[model samples]
Structure formats: C-alpha cells, structure tokens
Target: MSVATLSLFRFASLRSRLWVIGQMALARRSAAWAGSARFVKLCGSGSGVGFTPQPNWSVWAIFAVWPDEARAREHIDRHPVFARWRSHAIEDWTIFLSPVSARGSWGGVNPLIDPSAERASRTAGPIAALTRATVRPQFALAFWRRVPDISKVIGSDPKVLFKIGIGEVPLLHQVTFSVWPDAESMAAFARQMGPHARAMQAVRDEGWFSEELYARFRVLGTAGAWGDKDPLADALAGAAAAGRRDAA
Candidate 1:
C-alpha cells in the first residue's frame, strides 16, 4: 500500500537553520535524486503557524510519499537529507500515514496519496488533513486577508491535536497540515458555516488558487515528539481502544 510521512524539524540555533537552508537549495540542484527510486515525491518547506509570510527559521518540514512502508522507512534511515536534518535538529517528529481520501494535485501531480487505494474498514480514527494551494498573483491580497481569521478558528479548536502552516515560497505557495481527534471533529470544523466556509467559496468563485490539493490520511503511527510530547498520543490511544472493541 502507498505510505506517506511528514517530518518536522526544530533547530535551536541560527547556524543550524542556515545550514539546513543551504542544504535545501543544494538538494534541488542534484538531478539524480529528482526522480528518486524510493520516494514517489518529496517536498521541503518552511513552517509557519498562521497566514503570515515571514519565515520561521527555527522550524522546517519535509513531506514525502513512498510506494510502501518498508521503502519509506529505509529512506528515512539512510537518506542524506534526513541525515543532515538529524544532525541539525534539536527536536524532530515524524508521522506515518495511509491515504483515507484524496483529491486534487500538488504541483500538477497528485503525489502524497493515491485515490485508488482501498479504503480502511474502520473510518473513525485519527485523521490527518492536508490542504495545499498555489495562489494566483492577482488574488493573493484577497486570499491572505481572509487567512488569519480562518486560521484562528482552526488553531483554537480543541479537537485539533496539531496544526502547522508551511510553504515552499513565503506567500504564493502554501499548505496546512493538521491532525484531528477523529474524522467527525475535523468535518465539524471544516464544514462550519463561518469564515472557513466563506473562504472555500471565495477560492471557487474568485479563482484564487491556480492549483490546489486537499487530502485526508489515516494515522498509522508516529515517532519522536513535538514540544516534548507526542501530539497525537490521545488520538492514537482512542483509535487503539476502538480497534480493540471492534475486534472483541
């Protein structure tokens, strides 16, 4: 089955951050790894909390999709980029996921999850949601103006375990990754008749995004910690309980 991993890195010092930035730029020049054998697609991005364009130098992230879990694990264990990140990051977290549902594309290619993958028999577990978009130049101002309020709504929701705003370029290319307790909770926040809903309508009406992708994943497992605790611990535990009850 197709597997995906999202890794977060936190650098405590300025020097480490600069080193990572240089390495990220250098990675793009090496064409040999462009169509890597193990990973189907990979993206490295700067992490931001809200809609702001400013770079958060201290934290960075890498999202990758693989043909299977074994290859994904092997790449993480041996890849040079991962090695460099390990050396620089003071704290890091990685989560493994399987596609629950996906639509749209990233950079004109739908890489993270395959739509044809068989659905899990259980659909009520922890959910990982990803939304990516390339903003049209003309609509950039209007798009960003509506972000802070929508972001606030998502960020303040108690059901959301973890959330981060990341992008390749500061303003034009943006993505958000969030983990929720369950699919229902995620839907509740997303389907709310508020700024979030209005923003979705604006995207469709104003043609704000030149390209966009929205996807959901089933959380398989996670390694390491964010802020000294596994952010999805509670969600995972609840999923485990549900699985046990179903088995019984």
Candidate 2:
C-alpha cells in the first residue's frame, strides 16, 4: 500500500472540557467508518511533553501515518470531531501535518556518562551504519536528564540499537515514539537491557519513574515545517529538508 506520514503538534489547556469533547467526537466518527471497505489501516499515535501549572495549559505532539493525504483529509473533514473545534478552531490549538518519505533512527550520547565516549561512540557506529542501510529520514534528540542515560543501558547490551522518540501531552504523561532497524533488532533489544524494561523492573523491584510516564508508537507519517515550532516537527522537517538538499 502507498503510505503517507502525518504528524500534528498541538497545544491545549486541559482545563477546557471542549478539547476532550472534540477528541471524543473525532473518535466517534472514526468508529462510524469502521465497516467501510475503502478504509485502510492508520497507524495513529502521539504523546505530549511539557510542563504547565494548570492542567488546562498543556502541549501535545500527535502523529499518525495514513495510506495517503486524501484519506487523512477525508477523515478530518467528515469527522464529527471537527464540529467540536468550530468554536475553538485554531484558537487555543494549532496543527501541522506533513507527508513522510521514509523513517529511521538516530541517537545522542552524553559526554559525562560516556566520559571516554568510547562505548557510546562505538555503540552508535554499527547501529548507525545498519540504520542508514535499512531506514531513511533519521533523527535524534538529546536529553539532559537521567532518563536517557539510564535508558541507553538497554541499547548497548547485546548489540542493541537504541531507537527512541519521546513526546508528551501538557503535564499529563510522556509518550515514547520509537522504531528499530528491523524486527530482529527489536526482538533482540527487548530481550536485553532496554531502558524501558530495566526501568520498569527497577520500579517494580523498588519504586522508580516514580513521577514519569512513557508510551510508545510505531510512526505512521510526519509532515510540516519544524523550528520556532514543536521540537518533533523541527526534527522531521529538518530531516525532510536535508533529504531535498541532498538530492539537489
């Protein structure tokens, strides 16, 4: 099937009940079309990442990949969810979507933890080479917190390739959007010291990620201009623009 990627970086103050209703309306419409044969599988998922004192003022990055833009647009236009946004359309929130040509993995390493940067650097080399060969449109983000550091433990063991994308909704929860080079890599990674698994075990053994939450997604599509915008948008846009510049 032909595939097109769509990513939306949106902001909302969870304090407003209308936002919740709009989401409900949209879901209802999608459910209505469930029986249609023209329907194609949509890999839709996203998460939020930010801090807002009020539950109402939260930002979320939502993304999904569709078979094509036409289907994506059709879903949005005829969906009951659009009605909920009539009064608040583009007011409290904004959406940006772009079509993805390909997808891949990139990762960041720390100088402090990897004081030698040997293991960190060495680990990335093979993984990067494999990802380049198998995946396209690669990107990575750096985190100053202990989370990523602790997370990398999983990537290094058993020659695991670390592929992590993180997102969130306001102050609620953080979602992890990740893609491995292949099913084998993912299976192997899962069997070893992957951070999420380690962290979960740590928490169960003790109490950890005490206040943090994470979700994972199999990316669908990505679109829109990045920078001076959402971080994820910027990354995807940067990757796309880079692809164009490379071809030129």
Candidate 3:
C-alpha cells in the first residue's frame, strides 16, 4: 500500500511581508521542479481558522505522492534543486513524516475548532508532539499560483519514496506525512539538503504560503494508523496514539 508523508511547521520569527515574498519565489520554483518529477499533485498554504492569534506563521501544506519509501528516499537524496538552494537559504529546520492510514474532513469533525463541540482535543497525552494542537475549521487558501509545466517537456525524471496526504491542524500547522526508514534518517535529511530545508528558505525569502511552519517526527507502531488513511484523521488518531502509554 502507498503511504502518506505529512509535515507541519511553526516559525517564531516569520511575521513580515519580506519573508512572504521570498517564500513565493521558492514555492513557484519548487513546485515547477517537483511537478516535472511528477511527485507533487497539489501545493498551497493559508492562515488558521477558529483558532486565536494563529501561529506567527505556518507552512499550510507540502504534500506529494510516491511509489514507495525507497524511491521517495532516493529522489529526496538526489534532487538537484534541493542541493543547489541549500547553500545560502534555510535554517533551524525540523520535520515530521507520518504514514496516513485514513482521511476525512476536519471542517466539522474537530472539537477545538467547532463552536458547539466539547473540545475533546484538549485532552493531553505522552506523545503530545505527534498530535493535533492547533485547529482550523476551514483552511484558507491565501497564497497560491502556478509555476507552469515546463519540467515535463524538459524530461526531468524523478520518483517518490512514498505517497503523501496533506492535513491541516491548528497546533501542528503546515504538516507533511511521510514514511522513512527511521527517525534517525528523517532527522539526518532535515539536517542535510532536504526539500523541507529548501522550501523553508523559499518560503522565508518569497513568502510562498500565507502562514509559518512547525514540524515533528514520530515512528508508527502496529496499532498506529491514521483514520481511514485520511490526513486529518491520521493527525487526530496519531495524536491520540502518541499519548497511549498503556499500549503494548
């Protein structure tokens, strides 16, 4: 089965028009490149809803689909655009990749974001980092545009390591869920010339999306699965699972 890679980012210092501009340039270019590789189907960003203050900023979503984990790993390991851009841009990068086991609409299901709900999401757990923190009833498509489709004509062949599902949550904003060999490998990529790093700089420089970003990485157990493999469902389920201190 194909897996999903979800990532969310929160930038403490990302609150300026200049940063937004820089992010745009990077996103347009990155989208063009990834589009050529046939890895990304949709890419966009926006602000928070139903939540207060919103995050300083968030990387709304960076989602893609791949054939498998090995392919996804290889493509990420040897992407030219990523290698070239990592030199001057990007800093303080962190990422999370969760294989989605489910999918569903968060517009009405979330408790914290809903006006009439009991706020069930407020309950805390051990794996707090792996659960939903911020809640958005409806996602705002604030910064979005096209970079054209010249990559396919150029014949830039690229493959994916895993299939990805995009999710939107208030706390874990700008999330990307992916399956990697281990947390160590995921951490290494974050430290090296990874797409997350490149995109971070791009967003900071050109302001690709409307919000800032914050990410976390977690390993899945046999019982760990996203609800209906939906990104939003996966986030909620993951959050709940992370706090399961009694699981065997």
Candidate 4:
C-alpha cells in the first residue's frame, strides 16, 4: 500500500536551522532518496498558523510519498538527509499515513492512492487533511488577505486536534496540514458557510493558484508528539479497536 510520511524537526540554533533548509533544498534535487521517493517536499511553517510569509527559523518539515511502508521505513532509517536532520534537530516527529482520499495535484501530478480502491471499513478514526497551493503572482495579494480569517476558522475549530500551515516559499507556495476527529467532522468544517468556504470560492473565481493539491489520509501510526502528548491518541485508539473488530 502507498504510504505518506510527514516529518517535523525543531532546531535550537538559527544557523543550524538555516543550514538544514539549504540542505533540504539541495537534497530535493540531488539526493538518491529523492530519486526513489514518489513525492518529496521541504516546507517551512508560519509562526501562527504555520503557513505565513514570515519565516519560522526554528522549525522545518518534510512531506514525502512512498510506494510502501518498507521503502518509507528504509529511507527514514538509512537516508543521509535524515541523518543530517537528526544531527542538528533537537526534536523531531514523524507520522505515517495511508491515503483515504485525494484530489487535485502537486506539481501537476497526483501521488496518492485512489480512495475507491480501499474499503471504508470504519469512519471514526482521525482524518489527516492537506491543502497546498502555488499561488499566481498577481493573486498573491488577494490570497493572503483572506488567510488570517480563514486560518482563525480552522485553528479555532473544536474538531481539529492539530493544524499547521507550511510552505516551500513564504507566501507563494503554501500548504496546510490538519488533523480532525473524524472525516465527517472535517467535511462539516470545510463545507461550512464560513471564511474558509468563501476563500475557496474566491480562489476558484479569481484563479488564485497556479498549482494546487488537496488530500486526506488515514492515520496509521505516529512517532513522537506535537507537544507533550500525542495529538491523535484517541483517534489512534479508535482505529485500533476498529481494526481488531474487522479482524474478528
């Protein structure tokens, strides 16, 4: 099965943090792991929503799609870039996922499994949602104008366990990764009559993005915590119970 991994690294020193950014950029183009990886993206987080033009020098992230769990594990365990990150980062977290649904494209290609191919055995597990965009130069102003309001709507939502805004470039290339209590809860928030929906409508009406990708994943497992505790602990437990029931 296809697997997606999201890794976050926190650095203590500014120099080291900046150095890793350059390293990740270079690795994206030249690393052997990148060659084998289905999709690879190096991202920076916004201070508040974790997706602004203002740089967050202390934290960085990597999002990758792998053909299977074994390859994803092998790359994380043995890749030189991963080693480099571990050496400089004070703290790191990685979450492995299985695509439940995906739409649009990243760099013009969809790298997730088709949702129809997988059976929807249960519907109570945590849902991981991703929304990314490469904004058109002319639309940057309009796009950012709507961010704060829309971000507030997302960050304040009761269903959201965790959410962060990340991007390769500050404003132009942006992405939001969020975890919700369940798929239904996530859909309700997204489809609600709010700033988020208005922003989506504006994006379509104004042709805001040159490229975009939106995907949802099933949280298979997670390593480490976002803060002091696992954000998806309850959801993971629910998933485990569902799996056990399915096996019976």
Best candidate, lDDT: 4
Model 1 RMSD in Å is: 2.5
Put down candidate 3 lDDT per residue, 135-230, tens digits, no spaces. Answer: 222323321122222212112212212222233333333333333333444444446534534644553465444343232323322211232232
The count of residue-pair clashes in candidate 4 stands at: 3
**TM-scores vs. true structure, each candidate:** 0.89, 0.36, 0.32, 0.89
Per-candidate clashes come to 0, 18, 56, 3
Error of 4 at 202 (Å): 1.8
**Prediction 4 TM-score vs. true:** 0.89
Residue 109, candidate 3: alpha-carbon lDDT:
35
Q: Please say which candidate is ahead in lDDT: 3 or 4.
A: 4
lDDT of 1 at 176: 78
Q: What is the lDDT of candidate 2?
A: 0.32
Off by over 4 Å in 4: 113-122, 146-148, 245-248
Least accurate 10 contiguous residues by lDDT in model 3: 125-134
The TM-score obtained by model 1 is 0.89
- Measured on C-alpha atoms, candidate 1 has an lDDT of 0.76
